[model samples]
Target: MATVADGHHPFAFTFGILGNLVSTMVYLAPVPTFYRIYRKKSTEGFHSVPYLVAMFSSMLWLYYATLKKNAMLLITINSFGSFAEMIYIVIFVVYAPKDARKLTVKLFGIMNVGLFTSIIVVSHFLVSRAYRVPVLGWINVAISTSVFAAPLSIVAQVIRTRSVEFMPFRLSFFLTLSAVMWFAYGLFLKDICVAIPNVLGFVLGLLQMLLYAMYRNRKQVIIEDHEKKLPAATPDHVKNLVIIATLAASEVHPVEAQPNNRNDDGDVNNNAAITEANEHEQTDDHRHVENASVEIQPNETPSAV
Candidate 1:
């Protein structure tokens, strides 16, 4: 357990501390998320896969930090992450419905308990002591890289939805800052395992921030408010009346044709003729309607009685 001061590169040590601070904030970013879940008393369609994977990643990193020397920063941040992810999982399980709870528990058992135990046993028993750290470091690297890439789903969502509602700028900003800090710390610490994943993290974080900026105001799917309901279908009589009125009015005030219009051999005149035909049709329909109403009247009127 070498302190940051004990290391030859004090800059690396300082960066590690900074990384720890930033990473801690990144880890705590989900507190509000979980709180919302808690207050709602339901998982509200939010999947538990993320927390499960995060816990798994933290566990893997924790194991790696324990094996590697002078990786106290890795040890600390991952430790915090492991604890935080666990609490989040617990909250999720409690609020989740029966099917979700079952699925979550199954994944935790397979990934965290069963799969994790298998990794420990295989690495411990089969791998040599000298190669153990390297093997684990590479494995951790792979997992960390994947964890960083998990945000790509959100990126795709942001792009497809053109909305930044689910992808908060603050979260992306902190993730980017954490990535920068951790990368610097790992660079100083001279641990490739710690350095590699943060490289990807930094890139993804920047991409998320870019997406947030590009789409903060613009969305792919515009959910224009349909507060005003569509007008009901026009009644047949009403439609006829409107059509008749429009036709009669147009015929009364027909537009004068220009020389170019007259060149087409009564092209403008055709419109006026059409309006006259429409008016005739409407007058015929109105007369038929009046006749039908008269036919369907009561046998005797009140004045006649």
Candidate 2:
């Protein structure tokens, strides 16, 4: 019995080599974030799913490489990938909250250990080496496809909040670029397994960038709305007048209040007295209102009046 040679072209080989280098760089890009987590002693709001999926992808690729002849590049890159992702996961677990740490441990058990062992056992016992390669290739395809779906949660968040604060543009840009490089490499190498998932990755990356652009300005708008809703304080003149009126009323009053007289000449002296009293009362009320307004402004200074 004879085995078929995996097709390889020079262009495809070169592309694959380049793609691997670029992918390695991108994979290591999370170093700064992990460093922060290490320093802070907390994972904050960061999720562990990306690192988990990345580890799973690397593991799948490594399995596929074992089945394929002359897959040195694949094995090399994915080995680095496995180490990087494991380190990220470890950092996350160290800094994550109790519930998050528990969840991450469970995920590692289910995905990395249990599921991976099952695949290895089944593939080794049931399949020949030649068939093993193809089976693992398809498995890699499946894992990568699922990885592409992970960004949907972020997309939904962006839509709901109308904010792209969590979705960094540089990340989307690099992801899309990495996907393109990998896709080209896979296409040249005639490896449909590698090319297909990257197509989805590229599309998702583009969508994320677009969403980021759309909602980047929304933060300013939200701040402006808050500013518009705040109340303006009363002017100083009213406050001063009220204080003066209250002081005058308390300190200087005529011994007897003058009475208004209305005669047949239609001169109503009482009306004048009533009007003057009403004016004085209104002046006091205005001062009281202004004083209340000033008091409500927590950090205001009297000099501001």
Superposed Cα deviation of residue 91, candidate 1 (Å): 1.3
lDDT of 2 by residue, 48-121 (tens): 76678678878989888767765666777889999999989998898899998999999999999999999999
lDDT per residue for candidate 1 within 25-131, as digits (tens), equals 87787677678778989766466776788789889989988888778777888999899989989998999999989999999999999999999998999999999
lDDT for residue 85 in candidate 2, whole number 0-100:
90
In angstroms, give how far residue 201 of model 2 lies from its true place.
Answer: 1.1
- CA lDDT of each prediction against the hidden true structure: 0.73, 0.72
Model 1 alpha-carbon miss at residue 8, Å: 3.3
True-vs-predicted CA distance for residue 137, candidate 2, Å? 1.3
State in Å the error of residue 230, model 1.
Answer: 16
- Top candidate when judged by lDDT against the true structure: 1
